[model samples]
Target chain A: MELLEYGFMQRALLASLMVGLVAPAVGVFLVQRRLSLLGDGLGHVALTGVGVGVLTSSAPVGTALVAAVLGAVLIELVRARGRTSGDVALAVLFYGGIAGGVVLLSLAPRGQATNLDAYLFGAITTTTAADVAVFAVISGVVLAVVWLLGRRLYAVSDDEEYARAVGLPVLPLNIVLAALVASTVVLSMRVVGLLLISALMILPSAVAQLVGRSFRSTLYLACGVGVVVSVAGTAGSYYTGTPSGGTIVLLAIALFLVVTAGVALRDATARRRHGRQVEVHAAHPHEHGEGCGHRPVPHGDHVDYDHDGHLHAPHRTGTGTHYDEHDGSAHPPAAVVPPVGRERP
Target chain B: MTDPAIRLAGATIGYGDVAIVRDADLTVRRGEAVAVLGSNGSGKTTLSRGLLGLATVLGGTVEVLGAPVGRLRERGRVGYVPQRHTVSGAMPATVREVVGVGRLPRLGLFGRPGARDRAAVAEAVEAVGLADRLADPVAALSGGQQRRVLVARALAAEPELLVMDEPTAGVDAASQAALADVLARVSAAGTTLLVVTHETGPLAGVLTRAVVVDSGRLTYDGPLAGAGTAGPDCHHPDEAARPPVRGYRLDQPRPAPDAVRLRHGSR
Candidate 1:
């Protein structure tokens, strides 16, 4: 509790909470759209923005925001015009952003190179009051936009062409969504950095999906999981002297694995129980004779004799007695039915 | 009667320098249900894309709803459903939300959806029999259900002309029948429809006309009853029994002897 009273720790906590809230909220949509890679791509773009800020002796946050937004807009344009898949386009953009950043950094004067290793790997210890204020503003804007247009965004994301046909300004809405994702990436970059940001975006939401059955529920659960991971990982890092971003990512991954395992185990157990019950029901037909016992014979059985003498067999069953001479002789007789209580002789 | 809902004269369609369909002239009247029939890679999609302003017109004047194709706005005037697989099915949205997108054009820039827009979305969802699943996630739906959602989305726009590119592809027979029923309702309501498809079995009786495009050229266009006899070289001989021939062409104008010989063989 005393540790939580410290200014730096409080600042880190506030920043982590901001990231935890925004990342998963956006991630819910990204994960559903199969655009999980966008987080990673946008993070790399933000890194370039940071690099540009350092080289030009400008505000890193502002430069990073501008660069990330530009990257987002470019991605949207390329996706709309070209035949490239979003993931492929994102990959190209990500690598290009990293290469450009490295080049720009190398060209800068010696003292101007502020060595962005801390930003790249993420160091919550360095977060300032100004950074926290900027994060709050960004988070508030994103949340407000998402809240206001959540329904429309949900519609457009599902089927753009269909959405357009219905009269949704799908192109503009897509741009808006891209921008939101970009901003989220930029904001979270300070906490998780480029390399591990997507894990924060994707892992918590994925875990939430395992427990959540509906869209609204999923969103809530994801937000909850994200907050928990961020708080826990931040405390663990401070106390155990571990890397903050790496620890948070690892914690999220651990949560995802545990949830996935739980769901898988539950499903497997249910299936096994279902199989056993089916077997019991099949063997003890009298127990469910009035209800489910009337189900047709199991598919593998060749003959289904009625309560009477006539064999109720499927047409595919090639019993010799059921063959008609006029029937096209395309198939050979494969089954023989014996007279009840009598040998062939 | 003076201007048809859609008209294309001497239109050549292709991607980059190579032409797949060339020298085609076609017209579709208001309230007509036209089927574009062709085998795979026969430029049916290209023709549809050209009509929808997605593909470049290689060499012809194309008009939709009395306006130049290039100038026509994709608003409530024209609704389109591309091939089912063309859009991602795993997108995160509910059925109602998907249908609501149909109203985007009406909302215009900086305009929010009104009560009327919400009503139209609901009506469209009800029309496609997806009212019960309005709140359901699209990704969780079956393929046929997803197609229905798309159709509902198109219908919500309340277009004069609805263009469906392979609407029934990858759907079950029951869903296909349901789609046919929906199309019947749409046509009965006086919306012109242009559907590009390979299998015309379920849609036979209801289709007002048939158009066939091959190699970026219009081979046949006219009444369904005439589609069978429209082209001497048409592969689907069975089509002639259903519709009248409104127009016919070949990739290369056939020599008189071969045309005569082919005509004789078809008879």
Candidate 2:
């Protein structure tokens, strides 16, 4: 309880709370774009910024933000210029950033390397009011950009080519998104450290995807998960004398595992219930042939819905061999039927 | 007749400095439904993309709705459906939300969708016959259903000209029929269609003309039936409309074809 009495701890909690909400909120876009690890890349660049800060005796957070934003822009430019493949370019920057940071920090005064390490594993207890201000500004900007460009972001993320084809400025939108992600990484590194910051960005959204029904719902739930984890993990760390950053990351991961297990359990139960229904139909021959045409003539499309309101694969009998009785289409019968979650729109 | 919905005269379409489709000339008048047919690595997609400014016009002029392709500012008036691909895997959106993206161009800078946008999205979804699945996550739908959602997205824009790449490449007969049905309705309503595909199948009924592209050249540009007749001999009677295949010149090094690949990969 006395932890709250300390002004520094109060600052730390507020900063963590802001970082927690913003990281995953922006992280949703990263994950959707399959750029989940881009945060880690930007975080490495931010560490180099810290090294620059320590060498020049400037504000570490400010320098890190600059370095990260520049790195983000460079990456976008490289991808845009088509000088090299995206993965290759990102790989170069990812390693270059860390190596540069370590080398720079090593060349600095004796204690500066440890200060960089403080960024690697975070030093939340030392959070300053200035850090909280950075967090608030970063949060406001990230949230505002997301709100304003949310639909465009979704269209671009959904299919970049289609977005471009329809006249959305895909390149500019991409660079802006990268900048936002870079800012988020810098804002979060002070509370979660460079190494663990991406976890804050990616894990809550990953967990939310398992339970939330839609994209907007998942985003809402992800932010909720992040805030809960930040507050609860901060309290846990204060009480148990553990590192707050690692504790929060681990707690987020634990929540992900719990949600995954819950989804798996529910699916298994549904399958067993479906099996029972099939068996009951088998008991009475008349009930089977009408709607339960195990190998229905595939002349027309047949859609079967699962209890969860998702499409099920075409029904088949014990023969395990299905075919279109009349047309003899070249495509395999099962392949012709649409399976749940395999659509390519 | 009104000005063509799309026209490309002596256009060389490519990415950056490399040309994929060279000396291409084509036109589709308003309300015409034409299919661009080509094999893998052919330039059908490139030509369509060229009109949309996705593919760079290396030479000559390209126009859509009477505006230069590069400066075509009527964004909402031209709807484009790209090749079948996963929209989003990590963040699954409902069918409505996915279709709602079609309204983005109309919303403009600093504007949000209003009641009109909602009505358009709903109508588009209904047109695709997925009205029942409007609120369901697109990931839960079949591949055919997902493709329909994409069509719905394009339709929501209420574009005068719709350009689609491989709308039925991997789709089933049922879904293809449904797409053809919707496209028929769209065509009847005066929307021109430029569809790129290898096999017309169900779309055969709706296609008024077909342009065949082979090795970055227009081999045949005539009746839809002429596309099927395109063979090794390739004696397309319509010489004026057909661009001769400018086969590779051994003296000159071939332009690297990787630009299209790179562009697609980046996007």
Candidate 3:
């Protein structure tokens, strides 16, 4: 209650909440495109922006937003032009940004290099009301663009060639995605810090990929996960006197590990408990195996015989020689996958 | 004659200035199933890409469904099933979700897919025998099923001209049969087909006409039966084709009569 009473803490919560919503909304596409580390790369460029702001006495978040977006466009250009050296090129550019930042900040008049700590590790608990307003405005823009182009973005990110063939504007959508990521990184700079900001963007999407069955569901779940961890991590930091960026990232990774273990556990349990259409054919005098005249089909680790209408796979588990009946399809139904936790009926 | 589904005349197609398929001329009337046969790197794929407006058309007119490929406004009018390798992503997508991309051609970027779109998607999935797995992730399906999903995605557009590149490549025999059955049904439904392949394996039956691409030109364009036996003075045609699954593994793609390969090799 005391923490919420402070104006600074209230601003921090609002800022982090916006960051939570905007980050994963954009991050899901990045995850789908397998460009999850673009967020981290842009963060390094944002650090240079902060250094520029320090030397020029300008607004750090605004400058960082501009700088990060420019960095993203350049990265996309390199990635588009040369697929072979794109990663290596982006890596060099990202470090150059940080190196440029360190040089600029140290040269700032009456500014210590130590001042970069707040930008690097986040100063969420000390954010001003003005900072929260910027976060809200940028978060609003990012979320609106995502709402308008969510399907189009997914179509391009999921398969660039197919989207291009079908005539979706792949290049413009890619640039918009890069811009959204840059805006998200800068907006959350005060909440999660530029150094760890990408974790906030990507981790929730990673967790959602493991949790949700489809892209739409994954995007929704990513937003939910993002908000919960961002707000909770901020609150946790306020109460425990810990850093918000570290706390939020750790919480997210913990949730990802937990969801992963939970999914694996559910699948294993469902497969064993479901029995996979096991039936007792002991009364039948016919034994289906090699040289039995019936067609044999390989089914995963075992072989199934095409007898009658069902694929009869033999199993020996203390019940004599039994057969598992499968539908005519070559592969068994995915009932063992255990649909999303909410969809389980 | 009903307007041809595709017409390319004196078209020079390639990336940048390379000109892989040069000065090509071809035409296909609506409802005809034509197979474009050639080995890999024979510019067969480039010819199809030119038709789709993917590769650069440096000179001459290239048209699809009676309109220029670039100016064709109706995305749903021409369904494209690209090579199977280009259709997948690392992300998890459901059969319904993947097939839903086909509707984007009609729906555009902002248009919501209505009930009619949903019906089209469902019909496409049913046509491919994947209705039961509509909600399952495509990644969970076998490679054959994944290829079938790509076909369904293309079919969801309900295009008048369906262009498929290597539809049967890399698939198992059973899946090839299943795919052949789907293609047969699609062909019977009156959609124009242009399938590019190195060999017409199980697809030999669905495609009645064959256009052989070699040395940067359509060396042979005739009935599927004749293209294979275009032999030293050709052979007789079989139309009384009962078992249509007989394959036609024609010439492998090699150096063109022109300098396309030489230019490529120098680079």
RMSD of each: 11.4, 6.9, 6.9
Best by DockQ: 2
Better of 1 and 3 by lDDT: 3
In model 2 chain A, the worst 10-residue window by lDDT is A323-332
TM-score of chain B of each: 0.82, 0.85, 0.85
Per-residue lDDT tens digits for candidate 3, residues A1-345, read: 888898888888898889999999998899889898899889999989988888888888888999999998888888767577987899898999888888888889873444788888898977887888788889889989998888888888988767777777777889999999999889888888888988998899888877576878888899999999999999999888899999999999999999988877777665554454343355575777779988998653356888877787765556466665666664543222323342221
**What level of docking quality does candidate 3 show?**
acceptable
Encode model 1's per-residue lDDT on A1-345: one tens digit a residue. 966888998998899998998888888787866778887888888878888887888888889889889998998888877554765877888898887777777777886746567667788877899999999999999988887777667666655544554446667878888889888877887677767888888888888766663566777788889988987888888998887899999999998888778767766664465356445434533321224323333111122323222223333224222311111211112123221111111
Q: After superposing candidate 1 on the true structure, give the runs of residues whose Cα lies further than 4 Å from its correct spot.
A: A84-93, A100-115, A149-156, A160-172, A211-217, A273-345, B1-3, B70-72, B85-87, B110-114, B228-267
The residue pairs found clashing in candidate 2 are: A343-B143
Q: Which stretches of candidate 3 lie over 4 Å from their true place?
A: A82-85, A111-114, A268-345, B1-3, B72-76, B85-87, B230-267
lDDT of 2 by residue, B1-267 (tens): 377898888878876666888788888899999988875556777788788877778777788988888663655578988776445557868888999988887777557999999999999999988887788777666677788889999999999889998888777777888899999999999999999887876798999898988767888888887677655223244333445445533222233243333242232
What TM-score would each prediction reach against the true structure?
0.77, 0.85, 0.83
Instruction: Evaluate model 3: give its TM-score.
Output: 0.83
1 versus 2: better DockQ goes to: 2
Ranking by lDDT: 3, 2, 1
Per residue, candidate 2 scores C-alpha lDDT tens digits across A1-345 of 788898988998898888888888888888888889889999998888888888898988899989999999999888777744877888989899999998888888765445666789787888888888878998999999988987888777767767777777788888888999899988888778899989999999998877776789988899999988977887788888888889999999999999888777776664466567556545544422336634433222344323222223344445442222122322212334433233221
Model 2 stretches astray by more than 4 angstroms? A110-114, A279-345, B16-18, B230-267
Cα lDDT computed for each candidate against the true fold: 0.70, 0.77, 0.79
Ordered from best to worst TM-score, the candidate numbers read: 2, 3, 1
DockQ, per-model, please? 0.19, 0.37, 0.29
